[model samples]
Target: MDTASPAKWVPHPEGPEIAFFDTETTVPSRKGESYSLLEFGAILVCPKRLVEVFSYSTLIKPADLNAISVTSVRCNGISRESVGSAPTFADVADTVYAILHGRVWAGHNIVRFDCPRIKEAYAEIGRPAPEPKGLIDTLPLLTQRFGRRAGNMKMASLATYFGLGRQSHRSLDDVRMNLEVVKYCATVLFLEASLPDVLSAATPIDELPITRTDTDITTSSNETSVLVAHIEEMKLDSSNAGTAPSYTTVPIIEGSSGFSGYLEPEEVMTQHITVSTLPFGQFAKMAVYHKDVPLHLCCANLNVCFGVSTKFLDNAGRPKLNIVVEIPENLCKVLDKCDEVAHKMSQEAGSISQWRPLVKKDGYVNLPTVRLHIPTVANGDHAIYSTEMYQKESSGNIQKLVFTKVDASELDTLFIPGNMLDAFFDLDVYDYQQNAGIRLVAKRLVLHSK
Candidate 1:
């Protein structure tokens, strides 16, 4: 995939139409090579009934014809000869813009792949890329609400699962398949929801999927996607300073600085730390505790060494948002001790997964840095940041930021490299599929104004 940052979208008019689109690009032959746009196709559909309103498809010739490789032809069958007589992207930018701009853009995997190509295509022509009013990425949307029922959740697999026919690997065909797959999935979910108990069994564990003993895709935990309201932002008025900690047990962890219930690492004693196992039905969870209370730390003025990263993704293709920050020795000492104790406890608990260190030494200078995960949970048809965020002005005034939309671009803006923040986080230990580690899960972040 291309390493170029995807373009951030600007607001568009609130139109009744939703644009379902796809792009076919040349497959890069080597690392750091970018994709060359070959074809673009889109269909304008009514948001209410999802019926087609307008359609457009065109082949775009790349500046360098040699960019089209044999591998690229095998992937999408867009040959250099096929597009040699076609209009270049610059020649057809106006048509593409008219078809896409100011609509709710919907596509599969476009967030990671096609969006950047579109932006770069416009940039190459020294033109502005058309922006969407909102986005509806069918990839994460289906994966979250529909689960892995259709296997890898790709358009091809989903089309096959629904007997919708083979994917053409062309831009126009793929977009149509994406919409049909969504419709079929939605219909099944609607029928299942009407008879919830009989169609799906109720289990004590909500997060755990209800499935057969064998590996069939049918699952009872089908969550319906709801209508999304407008994205609204609100600044939190005040922190509940005297209130109890949300993540920890009673005997609140108090601090004068930052938010309540977030303790500085200097206030933590290495000797007081212990890992305990708590039973949850048939499973047990290992947790780090300071004496008896669950341990969490808050550190101010941590410099960001690396910005928000979406390179790592969950099984469902959801971006695992995280950032790397340089840590102070005081914080490092406390975390190192915690890692040692937690790794031992995880092994004792019969976790066969390999242990990954929490504190990492990067570069030849060996600076101690830690990655703080900003987790995401499902909303109506999208994923939103689970971490609470606040912005602290140079004047020392802090206001919390509340986001209802699923845009990860906002994170790229806030968590730029070299920015400073006060981090309040907890240790989340997990052993899944032979990989295990204590993840520093951020609960609240107060971004400092430069």
Candidate 2:
């Protein structure tokens, strides 16, 4: 509650440091409810050593005590009674500003959540918010770097993955946990990076047989499919409907072979559907199969029930774009079987994440629908649409649209709800954090002429 800055303490004179911070806020229980800062905590650390040099935490009373609902207290255990006597944000504004201003900032989900909370706290006080020298939001950073072994990649989940004990959800306790989580992740990555080199030196690469089935990522007309193309292999193409074309890249085609055999939904047999694991543990892939063959199915002419959405985000802060479509009974049975098999496989693989079914029937008057993911590929430091995009004219010729840059909002204008289109997609199964389900990844989208 003290606004006074303690005497200076600098522990890393030879290296740069980052301020790892966290905030506890009022969770809006009602519509139009604004978040009020409940607590603030921060720790300064040397980036090179990942050692903390200073720490600060304090509770602040919000102007409106009524904002603290039972739901908010249950979320973080911070009640109005506890903060009633605590200093208001205005009291500790000086200390908070000094601790955060002009330094590199880092924390779990700081970019999307905490940073905005900080800005709002300052804005409410009619004061300019402190600016960081640089930013490092670990939510996106770890997602891109560490992979999703720790489940949804939240602070609590990461802590549980490392057996670091339960997260208290209090500001200072959470901030400290955030630092430890990053430290553990860095250690794991370091060890993993070194292993390949050590093993290579000890054993010649040529001597070891590569028994792992290589998932061919190329969806181009060359071969059809791979074992199950790694999501990042950015290319596109699809062969004519028959001939068992799979998702391929570079003119990324819809082939019966994209990855693990992209078959038509019409060709799938529910009784033959099953799930199998790829090589590697938590970071590995899963395959849905029809009898002995991998079941990566494609269907054409699905009606666009809903257009592009950006509600969920990816590692780089862009929307994890997808469109909703009305599906036929055949595709529904196929997807349901795939979902059933995949859910069981994830359970056998020891995942407790909530299962997300690709098919939806409840919200739309019991009409079945499936989502089609529109993915992106890295192009130097940026990403371009990975789904080969095209527009079919009313006259009947289909033409491709080339883009220099792209985003979810811009793509929104293209896939209008109720529009009819032919879609080619990969039925991808995934278990991340605590969410497991099959993803209908679109490889090629041919828009119908208006």
Candidate 3:
């Protein structure tokens, strides 16, 4: 999709228009690689009336077509030949700026992706990036408001969850898709919000606990079933009102932290879930000092790459181990806020451990890692079992895993580099037994299919 006739729009006239926009850019082949702007698309939505009044879309010719990698082409189906003669971003910057400047800019994942790309593009040309009257990044918004039962928080997943079909990935198509997805999510959220008690009561117990019935030693499907069980368990725990602590708006400004003051009071649900709860049960028969009631962490897709056993040793000279997982930059930002709240909670409870910040710095977190301490119950306690791994049998019932045992060696291998596991854990700040700092004590882990 290329050029479209935009509706006539007067900037800052009467009131501002809600500019829903999206961009398609060169997919960086390597880490830290820059994204080249290849396309831009937007529609001006009337806020008071709730209708799209204008739309604009255009293909942008990057300085180097080689910037579009094969992966990029596969992602959006845009090729060099397709945009060989298209207008460069420079040619369309004026129109884009005119349409977007002073408007409330909104898009899917724009805060972490599109918004930054747009700014980077302008900066490359030594020009000022167009300013948004206010910013609305739907990624965080919807993740908090709509909840993550849709699986991964990617746009395609959200679309699929709502039966909106595969996201076209092209600039304009994605913009339109983004709008429709938001509408669907908003509608569902509205109904839920309007009747919270009714919805909560009617909500099913599908998220409840699942126990493994059989000991089948066979397939990855078994592990997948265990993961599903963990997910269901999370759904039940997360629904509790006080279990997961919510937070007020933590306004993050781009570039310098000067507040833009463009955000409308009603345009954003500033409140969000911050401090995810710990597992529901206490410390069980595990080797470590078990809390009787285990708390659950908010279920998150975490990448556990390494473990350290020597730092904090137990009475038996065996190491009190901690697993390390990389945190995504965007999510790291939200978790930082969670860290603050957790720190406050622990302090209020008279904990004296030094608080550790979740996000070391802003902008980009390069495989930011956090330690998850795994406490052992005995000197010879090598047993590390996750909830029974399960796979779907041909008959569609959850079957037990071939390998149900998860010892230290197996855990070391299972949580190796490149393993992205969905985890439910406790965000515990400990000041006991010479171990202090926030520890993500994993209560459950579902191995992610590569």
Candidate with maximal TM-score: 3
- Tell me each candidate's TM-score: 0.46, 0.46, 0.47
Estimate, for each residue in 1-450, the C-alpha lDDT of model 2 and write its tens digit: 222233244233223557778888875533235678898888876554455678878888999999897657867899999898888898878777877887777776565467767887888889998877666666646655666565556677777776667889888888877766665565556445569656322353343322212142112322122211211121111111111112222332335223345677777778888787787664688888788876666665665666677679788876788898877778888888888888888888888899987889985625688889998777888778888777654334555667666555446545644345777777788877877898889888876542
Per-residue accuracy of model 1 over 364-403 as CA lDDT, tens digit each: 2267899999999888787777898876653355666767
Model 2, residue 302: displacement in angstroms?
29
Judged by whole-model lDDT over C-alpha atoms, candidate 3 comes out at: 0.55
Selected candidate, larger TM-score, 2 vs 3? 3
Best by lDDT: 1
Ranking of all candidate structures by their lDDT, best first: 1, 2, 3
As for lDDT, the candidate ahead, 2 or 3, is 2
Q: Tell me the deviation in Å of residue 403 in model 2.
A: 12
